[model samples]
Target chain A: MTLLVVHSRLGKHRFEVAKGLSVREALDITALRVRAACGGTGACGACVIHLVGGEVSAPTVAEYMKLGSDERAAGARLACQVRLKGDTEIRLDRPAPPSPWKSIPLENLKPLTHGLPELRAHTLGVAIDLGTTQIRVSLLDRRSGRRIATRRGPNPQGVFGADILNRLEAARANPAHAAELAKLVRTAILRAVRDILARDIGEVKAMLAEIGQVFIVGNTAMLALLGGRGADTLLDPANWQGAIDCRPHDVTPWRAKGALPCAELVMPDPVAGFVGSDLVADLLATGLTEGPAGALLLDIGTNTEIALWDGATLHVTSVAGGPAFEGSGIRHGMAAEPGAIDSVCSVENHYRWRTIGGGAPQGFCGSGLVDAIALLLADGRLKPSGRFASPPGPDGYPLDPNHPNTAITGPDIDAFQRAKAATAAAMSQLLIQAGMTWRELRRLCVCGAFGRTLHLGHAQAIGLLPAVHPGLIELHAEAALAGCEQALLSPGGVQCFDALTAKTKTINLSLLPGYEDRYIEHLRLRPIALTPTTGQRP
Target chain B: MLDRFIKAYNEAVFETDKEAAFTAVNTALAEGIPPEDIVFKIVIPAVEEMMSNITKDPDANLAQHFMTAQIAAEVTEKMLEKFEHPPEIIGRVVIGTAHGDLHSLGKRIVMGCLKALMVEATDLGVNVPAEKFVDEAIARDAQVIAMSAMMVHTATGEDGACKVRQILKERGLEQRFKLIVGGAPYRYDTELYQAVGADSWAPDGVNAARAIINLIQQVKHRDSAQDI
Candidate 1:
C-alpha cells in the first residue's frame, strides 16, 4: 500500500490514497489541482504532476522523457506515470495557462483558393486571439493564412469582466453577459472588416468578395460561449467527445453551426477544455510534437501550456499560470505594450529592467519576468528552490510599493518561482515519460512568441529549462499558428491534423505519484550556478 | 496647512493625502489658521482624492468613489473659492472617460495630481456617452476638454477626445476648448490625434494633466505679451 497526499490549492485539504489507482479514482476522493487533459488516459500528459519523495513508482516511457536530472534528483515524478508505492506527496503547480505553441503561420499558407470537396469554405475563416484584456482578430485569406487584415480592439466584453473564466462565469451569472460577449466579438469583427476594406459597416458582401473560408481559435470556453453553448454544454466533453474520449478527432464540432449570423466558427481541436485548439494549433506549429524521442514545448502566458512530444507518444499538460507574466497580476502591470518593462536585469541582486516602448516603464510584462527571475537565480537574489534569498549584496533591497523601481520583490519572485516550477515540472514530466534521459532528449524546442525573446543560457542556468547542453534546444518560431496555417493550407490539412492528433496519446501525469515534492523542489529560482552582472539590477 | 503644501504637491514632492486637507480645515478651526490655508490644503486635497478614486478601480463607479465631489462642487460656489482654489495653475482642464468606455485607473490618477495643486478637473466617470461631453463642456465653460479611453476598438474609433472635438466644432466652440486625448486607444498612432482633429495627446492621465498645464502656461505667456 502507498500513500499519495493529494492536497487542494484553494483549501488546506489533503487525501492519502492507495497505489496503482488512477488519478481519476483520486478525483473521486479529492477534487485537487489536477485538471485532466487526456481524459485521464496515460495518453495526454496534462495530468502530469510533481512527485515528492517515495519509492520510484515509475511512469510510462512517455512520462519519463519530460523530466530533467534536477527534477528527478529532487524526487519529482509524473503523476500519471507512477502508481503510489509508499507515503508520497503530489500537487500541481499553479494551473498552467494556455502556452499555445508559438505557431506563427507561414507567409503563403491559406485554407481556401475556392475548391475542394467536403470543405466548409463558406465558414468565414478567422483566427481570433481572445486575449484576457483585448480581442484581436486576424482575418486570414483562409486561402493563404496570409492574414488579409487584422483588427483589434479592447474586449467590449471586458465591460462584463476580464479573462475567459470571468467572461464565462459572467455569462453563467447573467445570461445577458453571454449575449453581450457575442455582440462584442461580432461588432469588433464588423468594425474590423469595414475599416480594413474601407467599406460600409454592414457590407459583409463586399468584405467577403475576396474571402472564401473561416477558422477561429480561442480558449475552449470562449468558442463555446461564442457558439451560444452554455457552460453545461461547454464542459461536456461528449459535445467535444471526438477529440478527448476517442483518439481520432471528429471534424463535426466545427461544422460551422452557431446561433449568431457570424462567420463559420472553426473550433481548434481541444485537448481538455483547458488545453483547447489554440494549443492544438500550437502543437501543430511546434513540429515533432510527440513521441519517445523527447522534446518539450513550454509556453508561458496568461495560461501556461506545455506539451511533451516523445518519439513514440505526446504528453500534453497545462497549468493556469494566470496573468502574472502578461503584466496583469501585480499592481501597475501591463501587457507587452509600450511603457511596459519587458526586460529586467540584476544590479547585483537588485533590479534594473528596460521597458518595451521605453520611457519610465509603467510596469512589467512576460519578457521582463523571464529576465527578472533568471537574473535573480544567477545572482543568488533568489534561492535555487525559488525562494527570495535576499542577496546580501549591496544591490539587494526590499520591494517597496511607493517606489516604482522596486520591481521584483520577494513576493513577486515567489510568483515567478511557482510559475517556473510548474513549467519546468511539466517539461520534466515529458522527459520522464519518454524514458529518454535529459542528455538523450536529442533536441529541446522552446516554443512561444515570448520564447523568441528569452535568453537561452539564462533559462538553463536558472533551472526553468533542462540543463541539456546548448545546441540541443531548437526554438520553433510560431508552433500554434503554424498548425492553423497547415489546417488552412493543404486541403487534407485538417484531416492530416486529425491524424496527427490521433497519434498522440495524452498521458494524464497527475495520477502519477510523487508529483508534489518534485514541484516543491523545482520552485527554487536560484540555480545551482553563478554568473557575473548579478550586481547591477537597477 | 493646505496652502503650505500646494506648490510641493505639484512638484511631485511630499506626496499628497486627504488627511492633509482635513488637517488644514481642522487647524484653521482649532487655531487662528487662515481661511486661505483651509481652502488650499484641506478642501483642495480632499477634492483631488475624491476625483482620483472614481478611476482607482478602473471599473469602480463614480458615485462609489467620490460622494464628496458634490460637497466640493458646492463649496466651489463661493467667490473666495476662486482665489483660494486657483484651478488655473495647472490649467482649467476637462477630463473624463469616453462614451461606452469605462476603465479609469489612469484618468483619475491624472485628475488627482492636477487638481491637488489647483488644476480644475471636470471628471465624467466611466462610460459617459459622447453627447454628455458636449453638454457638460458648455455648462462648465471648460478650457481644455480631455477624455480617456482604454479600449483598443474605441481607442481607434472616435470616442474620447475625437467626440469632444466634433461636439466642440459642431457647437462653434472649437477655439473655446483645447482638445486632448489619452488612454489605451492612442497607442497605434499619435498622428492619429491630428487626423481625428485633436489638439494634443498624452500617454496616461498624469501626462495628460501635465500636457494641459504646459499648454495653459504657454497660452498665458502669450496673453501677457499681448497685454504688454
Candidate 2:
C-alpha cells in the first residue's frame, strides 16, 4: 500500500492504493473527478497531473508527446499512464465553471402530446437528451403534461473518450470497456433523475411505481452504448450496409436496481445508419416531416447529422465532423459556459469578444470559434487554405490581447476548418443527391444547443451552412429533447417517427458520385455560389 | 547523350520546374535514351533524393518533394504518350485505402508511381470495401491488388485482406493476382502483413510501386512453374 495525496481546487484528498495501480485508477477508486478524455489510451492528455513528491513510473510515450520538456521537468505526468511506484503526492487543476452547453433550457416548451389518464395518475415521464459529452434530463409532470424540472451533468463515459470515434475505438479495443461505458451512462441517468426529483434512492424508487414512460434521444453511437449493443459496425465504415438496429430497448432494469423506479424506459428507434432517433426527434420537433416537403434539418455536434426531406423520401447522412464543434481537442477550447468567449469580431485590426457570463475569458466555445474564423477570413489574418498569415503566437491568435489564455491555436483553426468542411460537404452531397437546390428547400432548420448561439451570418460566410433565404432559416434550441418530450406525451408522434423512418433513406456519402470532388471543393472556407432564383419562394 | 539528359533532368528537378523536367525527358526520348532507363535512373533518383533529404532534415521543404513527384508522374505520363509500342502494359493493378481508412495521400502517390511505370492501375477511392478490390481486380483482370491500411484499427478485417484471400480462394483464382498491403501501421510488422494474408508489404508509396512490380513477377513465375 502507498499513501498518495491529491490537491485540487475541489480541495485535497489522501488515498491509500495498492502498489503499481495507475494514478487514474487510484483517482477512480477515491471518486476524485478528473478528465481522462481518451479513457486512459494516453492519446488524449486531459489527465495530466503534477507529481509533487515520491516516485512514479517514467512518462509514457503519450506523455512525452503531449508534454513539453519543461513540463516534464516540472514533474508533469499523464495520470492515466503513470503507475505509482511509491507513496506520491500529486496536484490536480480545477476546471472552469461548467459550460452552459451542459444544460438545455426548456422554457416555453408547449405540450406536443396529450396525456393518458391511467398512466398520468401513477407515473412521471422523463425525457433525456443523451449527448456525447453531456446528458440533459427533463422531468415531466404527468398530471399537467408540463415539464417540471431539468437537470444536466457531464456524461461519466466522457472520461473514457471525448469523441464518439474514440469511444467506438475504445469499445473495439476492449469488450469490458464497452459494457462499462453503457453501465456508466445508465448510472449517470439515475444520478440525474435523483437530482431532478430532489429525493433519496428510496423515495425515487417509490416514485417509480407510477412511472409513465422514459424517452432517450441521442446519436446511434450513444444509443448503442446505452442499449448495450455491439458497435463494431459503426467503427468500421466499410462494414456499414446502411442498416441500423432501430428497435427501442427497455432499459428500466439499468436504473431500477440502483434505487430509481421505472416501469418502462423506451428509447425511440434509431434512424437508419449512424443517424439515430435524435434526428427522428429533430424532424418531429422542427415539424419538417409534417410538411409539404423540402426542408433540411442539421444538428451539428462531434458528428454532424444532416437530413433533407425531398417530399417523397428523407435523405440523411452523418459527417465525421470531429470534436472541434464540442470544443474538445482545441488548446483553450471549452463548451458553451460562463467565462467562455461566445462571439468574436475584429475592429480596427483588433479582435473584440463577448463571454458567456461576461467574466474574464477562460476559453473559446463553438460559437465563438465560428465567429472568429469568419472574422479572421474576412481579414487577411487567416487564409481560406486554413493557414495563418503571420507566424502564430504560442497559442495562435488571442481573441483579446489582455486575455492571453483565450486564444485559438494554429491546430485549433485546422480542426475548425475540418469540421466546417465536413458539414459543408454533407450539405452539398445531400442536396446534390436529392437533386434539390438550396433555393428549393423551403426552410433550413438548425437544431442543437450549439446551433442556438451560432451566428447565422458567420456560419454562412464560413460555408458551414449554405446561402439560403435568411427568412427561411430557423433555429430550434434543444429540439432533440423537445422531440423526446413529444414522443412521451403523444403516442401519435411515435407512430409518425415509425413512418418517417420507413421513408428515410440513409445515404452513405462515400458511395455517391462526385462526393470526393464536392468534399474537396467545400474544404475551402468560402461561401457556396448561389444562382439567382428570383421566383423561388423564401 | 545519356549523361547530358541526366544532367538536364537533375537540374530541372533541383529547380522544381515541372515544365523543364518534362522537356528534359522529351529531349532524352528524342535522343533515343530509353524511357525505362530515364524513369529508373533520373525520376526515381530525384524522388529518392527528396525523400532522403526530408528524412535527414525534419524541417526540409515538403513542397519541393511534392513538386518533384508531380513532375516525375507527368514526365512518365508524357513519355507513355509518345511511346510507339504503347510500352506493353506491364500488368494491370487495382489499389485503394482499405475499409475504415480514409487517408489518401499515400495511396494517390503509390497509384501515380504505378501509372508512371506504364502499369494499368485502377484506383478505387479511400474507405473502399475489400470486396470492391477483388471485384475490380476480377473485372479488370488485374495482375496485382494493393491496399493501404493507414490506421491500426483499419488494417485488416474479415472483409479486408482476409476477405480478399477468401474470395480468391473460393474462386480458385489465388494464383491469378498478387496482393500487396502498405501503410504506416503494417510497416513495422512484416509478420503481421503475412498474418493478414498479404503476399508482400511496403512501407509507403516511395517503395510500394517496386514491391508491387516484384510481387507480380514472382506470382507469374510461380504460375509458370506450376504449369510446367
Candidate 3:
C-alpha cells in the first residue's frame, strides 16, 4: 500500500492505495473530484496535478505531449498518467467549484393559493432539470404548490465526460461504467435534496419522510442514462428521429436507493432522440404552444434545442452546438459563476467588463465571449471572418491587460464559430421548414443561463442569433426548471408536454438538404442572411 | 516571379484571405506563369506546407487548415479552366462520414484538399452506410474509399468503417479499392485504423488528404502491375 496525500481547494485528504495505481484512479477510489474531460485517457490534459513531494512514475508520453517542458520541470504531471510507486503528495490547484443555484422567481410560477386535501397536505415534491452540464433541483410544497427551496450544481457525471455523447459512448462501451454514471448522478441528486432540506426546513430525516413525489425532466440521453436503459438504442442513427423508449423498467430501485419516503419517482418520457424533456419543459414554462404563430424558443447549451411554432404545426430539432456556449473548450472558458466575466464591451478603445458577482475576472463565460468578439469586430481588431487584424501573441488577445492568462485564442474563436454556425444554421433551417421568415418571427424566447446573461445585440452582432427586433427577444434563465416545477405542481402539465411532443415534427437537420452548405456559409462571424419566403406554407 | 507568387499565395491562404489568394494567382497568370505551374508549384505546395506545419505544431489553427483547403480548391478549379492541355488526374475517391456519424467538417476539409491535389472526390455526405460507401465507390469508379467517424462507437461500431471493411472483404473487392479512415477516434488511437481494418488513417483533414492520395496511387499501381 502507498499513502497518497492530496491537497485541493476542497482541503487536504489522505488515502491508502495499492502500488502502481494512477493518481486519478486513487482519487476516484476515494470519491475525490478531478476534472477529466476525456475520461482519464490523458488526451484532454484536464487532470493536471503538481507533485509536491515523494516519487511517482516518470512522465508519460501523453503528459510530455500535453504539458510543456517547463510545466514538467516545475513538477506538473497528468494525474491519470502518473502511477504511484511510493508515498506521494500532490496538489490539485483547480478543484471543481460548486455551482451556485438561483431560486426560480415566485412571480414566474403559478403557485396554488389553496392547500391540498388532508391526505397529501404535509407531503413535499421535488422537480429536477437534469441537464448535460448542469443540474437544477427545486423542492416544492405539495400542499400549496409553492417552491420552498432550490439547488443547482455541476452534474458530477461530467467528470466522466463533458458532453452527453461522450458519456453515452462510455456507457455503451462498458456496463460497469454505465452503472457508475447512474449511481453518481442519483447520489448527487439525493445529496442535493438532503442538503436543501437540512438548510431550509431542518430535521432532514423528518423532511425526507415528508417528500412524496420526485418529478425529473431531462434530455433523452440524460433520462436514458439515469434509468439505465435506452442508451444503446440511441447510439443508432436510425432511432434518432423517432421517440426512444426512455422509461425505466422499474422505479422501485430508485426510491429504495435514495431511501426516501416518496411513494413515486416520476421521470416523464423524453422527446424523440436528443430532444429531452427539458425542451418540453422549456415550452411549457414559456407557453410557446399557446403563443402566436411564428414564435420560436431556443434552449441553448451543449445540445441546443430549437422549437418553431407555425400556428398550425410545431417544428423542433436539435443540434450538437458543442460546449462553446456554456464556456467549455475555450482557452479561458468557464461556467456562469462568481469571478466569471459574464459581459464585455468597448468604451473608447478600452475594453470594459463585468463579472457575475462583481469580483475579479477569472474567465470568460458564454455571453462574455460573444460580447468580446462583437466588440472586437466593432473596433476592427477582429474581422467578420473571425481573424485578428494583427495576429495575437502566444497568450492571445487579452481581455484584461492585468490578466494575460484570461484571454481568447485563435482556437477559441474557431470553437465559438462552429458552435455559433451550427446554432444559426439550425435556426435558419427551422424557420425555412416552417415557411417563416425573420420578419414573421414575432417572438424569440431564449432560455438557459447563457441566454439570460447574453447581450441580444452582441449575440446578433456575432451571428449567433437572428437580427430580430429587441421586443421579439425574451430571456428566461430558469425556464426548464420552472417548467419542471410546473409539472410537479400541475396535473395538466404532463398532458401539455405530451400534446407538444405529439405536434412536434423533429427534423433531422443533418439529413436535411442544404444544411451543410448553410452550416459552412454561416461559419463566418456575420449575421445570417435573411432570405424572404424560401418555402411555401404546408 | 514564381517564388514570389508561391510566398504570396501561401501567406494569403494561411491568413485565410480568399480574395488575396485569388488576386495572387491571377497576377501570376497575367505574368505568363503556366496554369499548371500555378497549381502544382503554388497551390499544392501551399496546402502541403500548411498541413506540414499543422503536423509539427499540435495546437494548429483548424480554421487556417479549413481556409487553406478551400482556397486551394478554388484556385485549382480556376486554373483547370485555363489549362493548355487537360491536367493529368491522380485518382478518384468516394468520401463520407461513417454510418451513425453526422460530423461532416473533417470530411469536407479532406475533400477540398483532394480536389486541390487533382484527385476526383465524391462526397456521400453524413450517416453513410457501408453498402452505400462501397456502391458509391464502385459507381464513381473510385480507387479509394474514405470515411470519417467522430465518436468512438461510430468509429468502431458494426455500421462504421469496420462494416465497410467487412463488405469489401466479403465481395473480394479489398484489393481493388483502398480504405482510408480518419477523425477523432483515429487521432486518439493511431492503431485504431488497423483494428477497424483500414489500410491507413490520418489524424486530421489535411493529413487525410495526403494519406488518401498515397492509397489511391498504390491501388492504381497495383492495378497497372496486374494488367501488365
Candidate 4:
C-alpha cells in the first residue's frame, strides 16, 4: 500500500491504495468526482491532475495525445491514465460538486400549465428530460400545477459510454448492455423520485398515490435505450419508422414489468431519428408552434436539435455538436457548475475570467470557451482557420501563459471547431432548405441550460451563432423540462406533441443540396458574413 | 531524382501554394521524371507525412491536411492531362458521411486523397442515406462506396452505415461495389467494419486510398478466380 495525498479546495486528504491503482481510482475512493467525460478512455483529457510529488507510471499514448510537453514536464497527467507506483502528492483537477447535481433554478423554469383547472388532489406528474450525460427530473402537483421539486444527477448509463455513439456501440456489442443501461436509468429515476419524496415522505406519499403518468422526453438514442427493445432498431437508418411511428410509448416495464407502479412511463414522439421529442418539448416550451410563422428554435445539447417554422411547415434537424458544448473533452473543462468559468475577457495579455459562483476559477464551461475563442479571434491571437497566432510549444493556444493550468490546446480547438461548424452548418442548411434567409425568420429561440447563459454576442462573433439583431434572439432555459410540465398539465398534451411531430419535416442536413459546400465554408472559424444592406446572417 | 520533386512538393503544400506545387510537378515531368514516379514517390509520401503529424498531434491543423489533399488532387489532374492517351482510370468511388453524422472534415479529406490517386470520385457529402449511396454508385457506375461515420452517431439507424449495408443487401448490390468504413467511431473497433458488413476500413485519409486500392484488387482477384 502507498499513501497518496490529494490537495484540493476541499482540503488535503490522504489515501492508501494498492500499488498500480490509477489516480482516478484513488480519487474515487476518496469520494471525489472528477470529470472523465469519455469514461476514462483518456480521449476527453478532462481527468487531468497535477503531480506535485510522486512515483507513477509513465504517461500513456492517450496522455501524450492530450497533454503538451510543457504540461507533461510540469507533471501533468490524466488521472484515469496514470497509475500510482509509490507515495504520491498530487492535486485533483476541478471536480464537480457532489451529486444530486444542481438543477435549474425555480425562477428559470416557466411552467406552461397556467390557466388549467385544479387536478385531482393527490395526482402527481413527473417530467423528465432524459439527457445523454445528465438527467433532469421535475415533480409537479397535478391539481395546482405547481412544480413540487426538481432533481438532477449524472446519467448512470454513462458507465457504458458517455455519449450516444458509445452507448450504441456498447449495446451492439452486447445486447444485454442495453437492458442494463435502461435498468440503470430506471433505477436512477426511481432513486431521484425517492430523494424528492424523502423530504416529506408521508405528505408526498399521499401525493404519490395520486401519481398519474410520467412524461419523458429525450433524444432518439436515449429513448431507444430506455425503451430497451428499440436497441436494434436504433443501430441503422433504414429502420427509421419516422415521426408518425415514433409516438410516445408506454415504458411501463422492460426488466420486470410494472416496476415503477406509475400509470405509465411515456416518451413523447420524436421529431425525427436524430431530432427527438426533447425538441418537441422545446417547441412546446417556447410556444413556437403557436407563435407567429417564421420562427426558429435551436436547442443545443450533445445533439443540437434545430427547428425552423415557415409560415406553413415545420422543418427540424439535429446537428451532432459533439460533447464540447457540454465541457466534456477540453482540459480544465466542466459543466456550468459553481467554480466553472462562464466568460472571459482579455486584459494585459492575460485572461480575465468570471466563474458561475464568482469563486476562484477552476475551469472553462461552454460559454467561457465560446467567449475565449471570440476574444482570441478579435485580438488576432487566433486565426479564423483555427491556427494559433503563436504556437504554445507546438500544440495549443494557452488561455493565459501566466496561468499555465488554464489553457486550450490544439485538440481542444479542433473539438471546438468541429462543434461550431456543426451548429453553423446546420443553421445555414436549414435556412437554405426553407428558401428563407436569416433575416426572414421572425425570432431565433435558443433553448437549453447552456443556451440560456451563453454569451450571445461572443457566440455570434465566433460564428457559432448566426449574427442577427440582438432583439430577435430569445433564451429559453430548461425548455425541455418546461415543455414536459406543459404537456402534463394541458388537455390532450400527448396528441398535441404527436401533431407537432407529424407536421415537422425533418431535413437531413447532410442530404441538403450545397450542404457539403456550406459545411466546409462554415468550418473556417471567422465572423459570419452579414449582407450589409439587408443585414442578413448566413 | 525523385527526392528533389518531393522536397519541392512538400514546400508548396506546407505553404498551401497550389500553383507552386503544380509547377514543381511540371518541372519534374519536364526533367524526364516519369509521372508515375512523381505521384507514387513524391505526392504519396508528402500526404503520408501530413497524416502522420495529424496522428501524433490531434490539434494539428486539419485545414493544412485539406490543403495538401487539394494540391495532390490538382497534381493528379495535371498528370492525367499530360498523358498522351488518357490513363486507365483505376476505379470510380462514391463517398459520404453516413446519415445523422454532421462530420464532413474527414470525408472531404478522404475524397481529396482518393482524387489524387487517379480514382474517379464523386463526393455524396455528409448525412448521406444508404439508398442515396447506392443510387449514386449505380448512376456513376462506381466500383466502391466509402462511408465515414462519426463516433457519437455511428449507429445504423437515422442514416448510419448499417443502413448502407441493409440497402446493399436488399438490392443485391453487395457484390457490386467494395465498401470501406472509416472515422473516429470505428477507430478502436475494426470489428465494427465487419459488424456493419463492410469489406474493409481505414483510420484516416492517408490509409483510405491504400485500403480502397487493396479492396478493389481483392474484388478483381475474387472475380477472376471465380471465372475458373
Candidate 5:
C-alpha cells in the first residue's frame, strides 16, 4: 500500500492503497468522493481530480481528453488517469466542463459597475430557480462571473394555483392568462435588475452590457411556460418562446436550440422534460460518473430521481415524490429561505426548531425534515412503516384533523414510503442488477441539498437509506452546486465536457422486477407489520 | 348492527349487482344515521363484503373503481342538496382546485363533507385563480380557502399556490385570505404547510370542517385581540 494525501476544502483526508490501484483508488479510500465512470478504464472525465502536489505518473487518455488547453497548465490530472509509482499528494476536484458552452469563464467575464444604463464594463445577469413551489434568483456579474448579489421572494405566479402542472394546464386553456404570467416574470426580473442597477451603477442599457450571459437554470416546465413556450406543440412554426440563447451542453444543436424562441431562453442541455435542466446541470456540475464504488445519487424534488453507479454501469430511476422539500406540501412549509425552518431538534420527547425568519414557529425545510425523522425515530414516534405514534402526549399539538398539510396522513406516509422505496428499490435494483448489494459497496456518497440536510441515520431509520453500515455512508453538502463550482476551479473546465458523453450508462428503472413490489411495500410510511389500515385513520 | 346490516346486504344483493353497495349505504344513511357511522359501520363493511366476493369469484364483473366513485358522488350530491343550508353556525368555507386543478372529485368530497357537517360553504369548483380565491374571499369573504389538490403534480396553478399568494401580495391582498390545502398526494406538516405560506390544512372531512371553523375563529380572535 502507498500512502497518499487527499486534500479537500475541509483539510486533509488521507489514505493508503495498493500502488497498482489507480489514483482514483487512493482518493476513493480517502474521504474525497472521486468516482471513475468508466470503472478506472479512464473513459469518463468524472474521475478527474487534481494532483495538487507530489510526483504522480503521466495522465491517461480520459484525463487528457477531459482537460482543456488551459487546464493542462495547472497540473490538473485525472484521478484515474495517473498510476501511483511514488507517494502522491492530490486535491479532490470535479473533472471536465458542464459543457463547453458553460465552462468558458474567459468569454463570460464582464466589467459592470454600480448603476444601470449608459455603459458599464460588465453586465449583471440573473439566474432564476423557478420551482413549482418557490422561485429564487441569483444575480451574477456577467464579466467576472461572480455572484455579487442574490435575492429570493415568492414566485408571484402562485395565485393562479399551486404546483406547475396546474399552472401549465391553466396556461394551456388561457393564452391571455399565460401572457399575464410572462408579464409578471418580466416585471419581477426587471424589478430585481432595476434595484441592482439603481443601487449599484449604470442605467438599464449600460448595465445590460456588463452581462455576458443570462443563464436561467430551472426545472423544464418553468422555462417552457415562463418563457411562453408552454403551449408549443410540435406542429407550430416559429415555435418561439422568447429565449435568450447561451450554449449550455455545447452540442451543435444545443446552440441552435438556443436560437428557437423561448421567453428569455438559455441552455437546457443537461436535463429537461419532467426532470428539468437543474438536475441534469447538477449531475454534470457534480459529475456522477466519477464513482464506480456502487454509489447512488438522489436529487429530491417534486419528482425525485435516483441514479446508481455500479463500477462499470450507471442506472437511473425516478419516483413520484411531492414538492415536500419546497414547503408546498406542508401546512406551514416555506422555501429554504431566510424565514424557513432549516433545522429541527427533539428534546424531552418533543420536537422544536428554529425557523428561517426566526420569529413565531412555522414549518420545516429539507433539513428540518431530517431532524424530524431523527427526533421521531428517537422517540419511537415513527416506524419504518412511516406512521407516527400520534405526536406523543394528550396535550396534543392542536393538529388540524382534516388539513392534510398539518397532520401526518396515511397518504403522506405512503408518499414518503414510496419515495424511500423508490430510492431503496433503485439502489437495491442497481446493486442487484450489477451483481452486488449496497452493503457490499465500499462507499456511498450522498449529494444534493436534499441529502446534505438529511441525517444518514434518520434516512436509514425510515428505510430511505439502503441496508448499509452507517460508517460507509457520507454526506457531500451541495455536491452538485459544489461540483459546478469545482468545474470552474482550474482552467479549461468548460471545454472538458467531451469526457462526459464518452463514459457512462443511463440505466432506466422500468426494467427492474422487485421494483414495483418494493415500491408498493415502501408505500407504507411505516413498514407494515400486518395489513395496513387504509381508508381512514382514527 | 350497522356493519352486520351492510355485510348481509352486500352478500345477498351486491354479489351480482355492483351498484348494490352504493344503494345499501344510501339506505343506511336515510334512517337519520350519521355519515361517519355510515362510512365506519355500513360503507366500510359493505366494501369488505364486496372485496371478499370479488376474491371468492375473481371473475365477477365489477364496475371500474372510478365508476363507483362517480356513483358515490351522485349519492353525496343527493344527500348534500337535501340539507337546504344548515341553520346553525356549522362553519362556512369555499373549496375547490387552484386555477389549474382539473381534478374535481376530491374537491367534491371536500364539499360533500362540509355539507355533511352542516358547514355552509360556497363551492368554487376546480381550476380557480388565486385572484378568484382573493375575490371570492372578499366577496363570500370565505373563512377558509379549502383546496383539494388531486394530481399532486398540478395542485398549484402556474408555479403552484404559493405563486398565487405571491401574486396576491403583488396585488396587495396578502393578508386577506386564509389557505387550506388537501389531497391524496399531500402530507400534513404544519411547518411544511406554513412554509408554503398557507394558514392551515386538514386530512379528512370531519377534521377539515372542524379545522376550518377553528382556524377561522382563531384568526378572527387574533384580529380582535390586536384591535383591542
Candidate 6:
C-alpha cells in the first residue's frame, strides 16, 4: 500500500491506497473536497494539484492538452489522470473561499399566528433550503413562530460537481457514492443545526429534544439524492416531465443518527420533473398563485424554473441554464462574492467596473457579464450575432485593461449565449403555451441571488430578460428561503404547497415543436422582441 | 459581375450579415444568374470556404459558425424555389441528440448545415431513443445516422450511441447506414467515437456536415457495388 498525504485549506488529510490509485480517488476516499466539473473525466482540468514531494506516474495526454507548459513545469498536474507509484505528498491550492450568506428577509415573511398540533411552548422547528450551490437553515421557536437563528453556507456536495446533473450522474453510477452524498448533506444540516443551537441556547441535547419538525425544500434531483433513491429514474429523459418520488423510505434512522427528537421530518413532494418544492415555495412567498393572473415568476439558477400564472392554470417548466449564470464554465468567472465584478458599464470609450464589495476585480459574475455584453453591443464592439468587430487576441477581450487576467473569451460568450437563450426561449414558450404575451405580464418576479444584483435594463438589453417595463419587475434574493420559513411556521403551509402543486402544469420544453427555433432565435445578443414571432429582431 | 456578387455573398455570410447576404442574392437574380448556379456555385462553396477557414482560426466563435449555417440554409431554400429544374438532393440523413441528453444546439447546427448542402436532414429532436434513430433513418431512406451528445456519460451511455450501434449490428443494417457522432465529449477525446461504436466523428458542426456527406457517399457506393 502507498501512503498519500494531501493538504488543503481545511487541513491535512492522509489516505492509504494500493499502487496506481489516482490522486482523485484517494481524495474521494478521504472525503476531501476537490473541483471535478467534468466529473473527474480529466476533460475540464479543474482538479489541479501541485506536487510538493514524492513521485507519481507520467502526465497524460489530457493533461498535455489542458495544462500549459509553464503550469506543468511548476509541478501542476491533473489529479484525475496521474496515479501514485509510491508514497506522495501534494497540495490542493486555490480553494474557493466560502460565499457569504445573503441575509434572509424576515420582515417579508408572513407572521405565523397559528401553530400546528406538534407545536408546543418550548418546542422548536427547523427550516432548510437545500440548494444545489448553497444551503440555508433557519431555526424557529414553535410557540411564538419567531426565528431564533439563521445560518447559510456552501453546499458541501459541490465537491462531486457544480451542477445537479453531474451529481445525479455520479450518484446513479455508484451506490456507495450515492450513500456518501446523502450522508454528506445530512451531516452538514445536522452540524448547522447544532452550531446554531450551541451559539444561542445552552444545553444542545435539551434544545434538540424540544424540536418539533424539520422542514426541507430543494430541487427534485437534490431531494432524490438526499433520500438515496429515485436518482436513477431521473437519468431517463422520459421521466423528466413526471413527478419523481423524492420521499425517503424512512427518516427515523436519519433522525436517530443525528440524535434529534423531532416529532416529524417534513419534506414536501417536489412538483413534476425538476420543478422542486423550492419553486413552489417561491410562488407561495411571492403570492403569485393568489394574484389575479398575468404574473410570472422566474427562479434563475443552474436549473432555471419558470412559472406563468395565466388566470386559471399555472404553467411551469425547468430549463437547464447551465452554470454560466452562476459564474462557472467561464474563463474568469466566480460567484457573487467580494472581489467579484458584479457590474460593468462603458465610460468614454473605456470600460468601468465595480466589484461586489468594492474590492479589486477578480472575475465577472452573472450580472457583470450581462452588463459587459450589453455595453459592448451598444458600442458596436460586439454584434448582435455575437461576433467581435475586430477579432480578439489569444487571451480574448479584456474587461479591464488593468486586470488582463480577468477577461472574457470567445467560449465565455458562447456559454453565456446558450444559457440566456435557454432561459429566454423557455419564457417565450411558456407565454405562448398560456396564450399570453410579454405585454400581458402585469407582474414579473425575478427570484434568486443572481437577480438581486442584476441591473434590469442591462439584463433586458442583453436579452437575458424580456423587454418588459421596469416597473413590472421585482427582484427577490431570498424568496426560496422565505417560503421555506413560512411553510415551517404556518399551520396550513403543507396544504398550501399541495394546492400549488395541484394547479401546476409542467411544459417540457424539449418536447415542444418550435422550442428549438425560438432557442436559436434568442441566441443573438439583443433584446427579445415583444411579439412572439420567430426571426424578428427587436 | 457574377464574380463580384459571389465575393460579396461569401463575405456577407462570413460576417453573418443577413440583410447584406439577401441583397447580394437578389442582385445576382436580377443579373440573370441562374438560381441553381446561385445555390451550387455561390452558397455551397461559401459555406465550404467559411468552414475551412474556421478550421484555421483557433478563436472561431460558435455564433459565427451558426450564422454561416443559418444563412446558407436560408439562401439555399430561397434559390431552390427558383431552380429551372428540380435540383437533385445528394442524400438523406436522420439526426438527433442521444437518449437522456437534452442538448439540441449542436444537432440543430448540423441539421442547418446538412440542409444547405442539399441533404434532406430529418430531426428526431432531443432525448431520442436508440431504436428511434435506426427507425427514422430507415423510414426516411436516410443514408447516414448522426447523433450528438454533449456529456461524457451520454456519449458512452447504454441508451445513447452505443445502443444505436448495437441495434444496427443486430439488424445487419451496418452497411445500409453509416454512423457519425459529434459534441464536446468527442472533441475532448478523439478515440471516444470508436469506443462508442461510431464510424466517425467531427469536432464541430461545419466539419460534421462534411463528414456526413462523405459517409453518405460511402453508403451509396457500397450499395452500388453490392448491386453489381
Top candidate (TM-score): 6
After superposition, the stretches of candidate 4 with alpha carbons farther than 4 Å from their true spots are A1-101, A111-115, A172-175, A200-204, A244-264, A401-405, A531-538, B1-105, B122-181, B189-201, B210-228
lDDT, model 3, position A471: 88
Give per-residue CA lDDT, model 1, range A115-232, as digits (tens): 2335454533555555445554555554433444444455566666666655665665566766666667656655544443331122344455434445555556655566544544
Scored on chain A only, each candidate's TM-score is 0.64, 0.76, 0.78, 0.77, 0.59, 0.78
lDDT values for all models = 0.53, 0.72, 0.81, 0.73, 0.50, 0.82
RMSD of each: 22.5, 14.2, 14.0, 13.8, 18.1, 14.2
On residues B1-228, what C-alpha lDDT tens digit does candidate 6 reach at each position?
779999999878766767689899999999899998899889988878877887998667776676678778888888888888887889999999998888887877788888888999998988889999999999999999999999878999999999999999999999899999999999989999999999999999988999999999999998899899
Tens digit per residue, CA lDDT, model 2, A281-396:
88888888777577899888887888999888889988777688878777888877556787887789888887764456888888888998899889878766565668475557
